[model samples]
Target chain A: MEQPEEVPHNPTEQAAICFKAFMLKNSPKSNLNLYDHLVRVLCKVMDERPENAVDVIEDLSLEVKRTGMRDKQSTLRDTPPVPAVQLLAEQQKTLFTRGSGDDVEPEEELVETPLPNLAEQSFYLEQAGVGLPREELQRIHLALKQLVDAQPLQTCRFWGKILGTQANYLVAEVDFREGEEEDEEGLQEDGADEEEKEGGAGDEDEEEATEEIDPLPVSAYKPPPAVPKEENHTGVNKFTYFVCREPGLPWVRLPPVTPAQITAARQIRRFFTGNLDAPIISYPPFPGNETNYLRALVARISAGTQVSPLGFYQFGEEEGEEEEEAARDSFEENPEFEGVPVPEMVDSMANWVHHVQHILQQGRCVWVNLAEKPEEDLEEEGDEEEGEEEPDEPEPEVGPPLLTPLSEDADIEGTPPWSCKMSSTLIPQFAIAVLRSNLWPGAYAYATGNRKFENIYIGWGMKFVGEGYTPPMPPAPQREYPSGEEITEALDPSLEEEQALQAALEERRAAEEEAEELEGEEEEEEEDDY
Target chain B: MGVTEDELKDKKALYSLNCIDWHLLPLPTPVLLAEVAAVAKGRFVGDPSFEYELTETRQQGEGDEAVKEEFTMKVTEEKRLAATVFNIEKDVSVVPRGAFIRTPHDTVQVNHSFQGLSTLEARNLGNYLHFTEPQQLKKKSILEMADLDPSIDFLDPLSEDILKGSWSLQMEGSSMCVLRSLLWLGLTFFHVPATPQHGYIYMGDGLKNLDLPFML
Candidate 1:
């Protein structure tokens, strides 16, 4: 990893330097050029910290250098190491002494949180962006041609957009309000011209020229009407574009007055505090993402603290089964002979693991809704003035409001008053991408993407998806993996041999202690004789 | 994959990234937690595209003021990953002019021209690139999946350190297509056969045509 004396002033230059180094080191004489990589690194950086472009780019290069180019090639999923990171068995208290308990982290372990992936950086960029130099803009546009190369994923915007609120937001399009200035200038100007002409011009000539009554005054090109100044202080801005091959980069992010999002974020925090017992909905591809998101809001009430009477245990399976024993028992079960189909066994096992993830510790797997448009967008279109500029024109086409979708998604109709909602597409829209980028890395670790010290043994299981009362799986069975000895026994012989050798080496240290003791005793005798 | 780590490591963990085989995914383990991450697979037709549909369904749940207040069946969801295949035009030049599309993951392509089909000719509307195409994934068998099979020794079952895989695929063969379909256009590592023995695959327009006949 190259260390920067200080972060370079020009991000593109630094990106160019790293990009060249990266290409030479990674793909010399290959098709991917320095410009291509520089753009991705730069755009991703600028999006996350628009104002801090220099810092972002420097941090990015630093990240690239420090982590090595090899690391970026893979997914951001953090593992609890090969032993499929199990939640560390916790004790009442931890010791500070060297190597005392499960709490003692190994010196070599890289317990690092992943920097946002290209996808996440792009997603955040979608909601927000930083202004860029025009030269960089040209570079991005030219790179757009190159961005179309074959890719697994590519960045794009969500269709149903929310216009804006108090926070900073990207100007997606011109927002058309209901009322117009009503051609007051044209009417007033024409009247003044008529009065002046009535005195000077003859009636016959005036009548002949009437055919050309209101030739629009060739006044200087008037910039389009201004948006209500009270809404946002920042003037109209241009969006940042990057070369795209496939997905991973977010186009931009919107900052709206999403109190529910904030409330949900708070609820998420409280869920960790053991304040909410809202059952975690499964990850994506399951059904009912609404439930997952709505429950996110109800972790507690803001007015006063009222923890849900129901905790994680309510959603769990029958009690009395130990996690380790259950895991072992399930692991040992040859489901093929046990009368279950492989797929069924797989589902059952997945469910069991899912249950173990949810019950034994805090559940991290969250349901995030991917995109689908909402009604307000259509309504807002109707509300747009007919006199407004053409729809197809890129000139200032702002989007609709934010709150409706959240309230729509979160609405409660049939349920008793105790229930919250999972109605809005917004819940899934903003949250899903962020969740995937954030928690995906730790999904497999035993702590399921949590820290050992936090004792928050949890990680995302599966995101809830689909559109039905998909019959909930028979509650998850208790789960465990083979014990340390058993898990290790299945490992390489060299590892065991290494273990034995280390044990032997530790025991051998006693000889040195014994030798020193004998020498001291002999010395004492010699002194007595003297 | 050749696209290295986004999550920068502290100087301490740099060694893990430096080592070619050490990776953070699949949570490397000795005893195969074969069940944790299994390979799943499916097939695509001759063309490089799929049909997209947005379907809606209603789910009724009893809860507080919010639960019953919202949702008329779930609004606008995908019933399947892909409902139809959007064929790209055969002409290489038309690719950037055709349509915008994406994979199940957020991987997106603008003005994507797949090998052409007449059914979609009339519908080549350039206006709609915003809604990223949702993906279609089947309950693919572990054997059918891409990276999982290459590195894993299911037959012997975790005899060695769990074999890790980067996005390594052969460039000159049809394996690229099959692999490309699976991986979309993420960064990948390829094993170069020469003395030094390392190569990489990234999404690039320059190398669009390579070994074609060998793909599955």
Candidate 2:
């Protein structure tokens, strides 16, 4: 609202101009930059029209002051957050502490897990022309004994070697003592405490500053279809694993595997270098270190290849009908299983069946979360795009049932994954029957005429893909520009369309001439007035 | 009586008995008997039985015209065990390079000067040959046999077994060399590092592993 004859002057704008001039003339050269910054900040405040402009400017000023003084005050503040190396070291300390139990009974050891006679087993293995060298076998046996005594384990079995570039990992699979769930809970609490300490150290002051204004509650990003605890004596998560570079070295227990990790591991093919902490720099990068990957792989190999003679084991009794109805179905050794003849076993692939439950596409032997979560939650989290499951949906495909014959499972290439053989052709009755997995090379199982069988794997864990193992190649780089159909001028245009284009062009030119003529006349009139 | 000197002289002829020295070259029959006795002692609870028979019953022609013929082959437990040992040895028994050689008279004899295989040669299954006769040399073309040593190559190499990777050669205790056969489960061949000390034994049941080809 300016009056016709009055000169408009905003006091604040005038004042800002005056202040800038005064500062330039009066302030020392050293402080000139700071003064100019102050002027700019004020100018920003006046130029922007925000609802809470005063409060916003006040925040901006305080932020500027804090940044200006940051260098001087940095030394006064507490040391920065704990580095990744220290955190890793702390984690490793906890792992070792957890594995090494102080008290293990000596007299009651015999009644503990019945350890396989390594020397006797080696003798048979050598006869069949499989297994590690005698010296290696002896070392492994002794080391495993030492491990059993050191850890509070119910049972321990040597789970063969996984060949690595630098060194091989001698894995020992062990089950926890009965009712050891309390110790696991304690371990989890310790982990939680450590996490709280880390969180408190890094952002305690910031949290205090905004205490009155509650922070937004952020829901953690949980990987879908979380792996359930293995409460039974079967499946991938039933046992823990400890691995070492050499037999005599200290055993490092690998972290329990997650279904997500196993699923990711299935997509990658990498050689272990016997280092647990080594990074897996791969496409769709692995979630954890080699230790976790090794655990997942061990689980996979167990589910895929661990097998026994048919009728050797029967489905274990499902305990507790109510509440635990969806419990994992397990297998137990059949007391009445009489040994099959070696000739009969060697004659066909049907005699051999996987005793371990089959691993479903979801990387677990059993899908246990069926009755727990609502159908909607399951659908949202499940990897499959299973269309809106109804409340009464049929049981999802878990996989072929436990103890399915080896012959029933075909290799990806349509060839039988297993090859059955008798130990000796000269003496059919006395010879043992052997089954070797062609799908996963280096996995072999042998059974004697009587009730005795064992499965062992010794290879650079890789699936046989017909040819030599090759790391999958990265996808080809995307083309920068999309290709389009080539346009040629050979085709003639219709007469009507051509005439329309010509008329539109002529009309546009005439309009341009008219505007130009009007502008030239206005210029002439202005010149006459001058 | 008065007789011609030439005729009378021949009448004083003498005969001398000649026997094979069992110490130098042990009689195979007795050794075979000992093996059977050991096996029979275990099977029959210290009663070395002399009777074990394998009966073969064949029915000829269709159901209506079928003539049931029963053939009873009378065999002792000893003979059966000996036959089994012979069968296993025929297929899987192996010897290191130069351990045996072909004589000019077309016979294979132990090479006394073989000083055992070198460590490098010991590692490879190709350096060991089946103790039995060489079927491969006879089948090889003249061009393929050009580089083969007739004296040493008179037997097929263990590497030439029908199923490749059936033979596993390894060093035990870094001193004693051992070769095991996957096909013949209990067949084990041991050789001292560097001496004319090598031997093979098949202690498995009397059966041939026909499934080896599939395993490989």
Candidate 3:
């Protein structure tokens, strides 16, 4: 906790020890610094392996006599020294010591005092910039205060991403279950209660009650909703499952953002790029981007569920404590699917009718597309997805896929380090089987005291919701989509072409009607003006 | 200091693209010459009532990757109509022959408002210089450098605290442009007990960051 145990008495050794302390978070030393090659290598070694840097530095100083790698002009003075060990035993101990039963890790006060803490309250209340004065600040604060009174800031915003967007159709939630560490949270709450009492706050009973309760165990972190045995209508409970990253806050999970919502989020981001300050408004009877294709495919797999319902089922065993016990007992693999199954590419093509019905059902949100009797005209809207300009000249029955996948899902992803082996082209029949598979080993949440990390177990099998993340009704694996048409109808002609023709005709009819109405209005206006 | 009126004029705040609650049909590729006229009926792109004729797709990337097309995209715009009627009236980006195909009656101006991250000041790392609020040596460092806007006040981003895990990683650009501002923009995940996923702020003038498809 204090300084290292053995502070070397010699000046050179002391300098070496101090250098190692800063080395961990510093950039590596350059090789071209030393004039001689042999001495440079020794200095490099000393610089790299800090613990025994002294001994290595000493040995190299003598050995410069044999090897010719050293520059001829360099001398013993050029060789930097090192300490005798691998790493300081005490320093190593500090790094490894578990947050000592508390959530606080080895937090050395590297800086005795923090710089002026930035104001935590919203800057909307601040009086700064070119012309505003204290009077303006006070007036604006008072006016806004009258509106909100004493209510805490209701941080309203959505965090969403399209799942199965990866080539392999794998989806990952960055901060899956970030509930505070077990008793550590409870212990902190107890400390807060004491502070409240000192401040003469009178909620002692509530504070006492909170202090008495132990923090929920880490295992108790609710996993993704398990496969829903109970049907989840998009309108009622679908958003509860959306996993998104907050604007700034990382761990807090907002309601589940639909694939359509993710697509919307992207468009919205770009829309605002030009118009930085505009209120979110509504216009079309739309669902989302071209997400229907994937959702349709998922629709087939989900046993005709209108939407690719995430709540429908769990992929494998919940990676809870009990599953770990079962994992030790079994070693066989499920060879059904090559990789895990998830809802991927759900954004490219979407089922607007199905998606909109859900949006309409969730009445009070900003993103609702109010259409007239939307459910009744569902069949009509499906045709809208097809672009109006259908090529009159028919091509072969199975032609090249229409929306040339701008690039492979992986190609688009550019193979970052976090990527695991997955597929852009999925196996449908095997996907169903994969979705039913258990949690793979490497993908479980890892939280030790204050340290928290979770990697969704990526595997060669398809992923399904375990019981924990599943909704009310646990998943009973359903039948797969009957048509073997992922590549055929989704990419190629026929479905979209036929729909496009229908849409073109419909557009013509609507245009004619609008034209006639405009003519009538213009004529009447002209007569009135005369 | 009082907020300048010009900052108010210049500061465009677009909050949500979800404003169009219903999705529009995917922007029709160059095909639909007839349909384009119909939608553009006396409006922005097709207001002149130009004869609708199918033309070959313009801007076709040559070679193996060129998309096989059913209809051509190059439409003779009756005239770009000054590109002003659609509220892109001021400081609109002009093209040396604009690429995004536009018909005179094209009513819907391609407007996107992805409220990008607030002002971030990054200096060339070689000299270990980090620009602050005022951008001058002392003033910016003294005053907490913040891109203050009332709209983003609700979403309080702790940009002033560099050590608070909200700093972006300086990575090589994704080849989005020939001329990069040489500045990387991205959102950072705060150092909380249970969270770790931050991403580059890749939304801006195409020159800033390439539109990479993957979510990091």
* Tens digits of lDDT, candidate 1, A249-278: 222222211223323233221111111122
Deviation from native of the Cα of residue B17 in model 2, angstroms: 46
RMSD of 3: 32.4
Q: For candidate 2, give the lDDT of residue B205.
A: 34
Model 2 chain B: weakest 10-residue lDDT segment is B7-16
* CAPRI grade, predicted model 1: incorrect
Docking quality band of candidate 3, CAPRI definitions: incorrect
Which digits, one per residue and each the tens of the lDDT, describe model 1 over residues B1-216?
213221111111111323465423322222222211121012211122232222334445645433323322221111111111111101111111123343334333332234332322212222111121112113435555553322111111111112212111222211111112111212233222221232223322111111111110
User: For every model in order, what is the iRMS?
Assistant: 22.6, 15.3, 20.2
Worst 10 residues of 3 chain B by lDDT: B172-181
DockQ of 2: 0.01
lDDT scores in order: 0.26, 0.66, 0.27
* Off by more than 4 A, model 3: A1-250, A255-266, A270-530, B1-216
Q: Per-residue lDDT of A1-530 in model 3, one digit per residue for the tens?
A: 54556767899878876665544333244332233544566666766765666666666655654354365446667554442222333333332333343244325422221211112111211211111234322332332222122122221111111222111121111111233223443564467468645754444454566678985333223232111111222322222221211111112222322334323232221111111122333222123332322222222122111222222222334433464232211112223423213233222212111111211112211223223223333446476534444324423122111111212211211221112211222443221111111112112111111111111222211112212121123446756547765645654568888799778866865686677865566555544753
Preferred candidate (TM-score higher): 1 or 2? 2
TM-score of chain A of each: 0.13, 0.59, 0.16
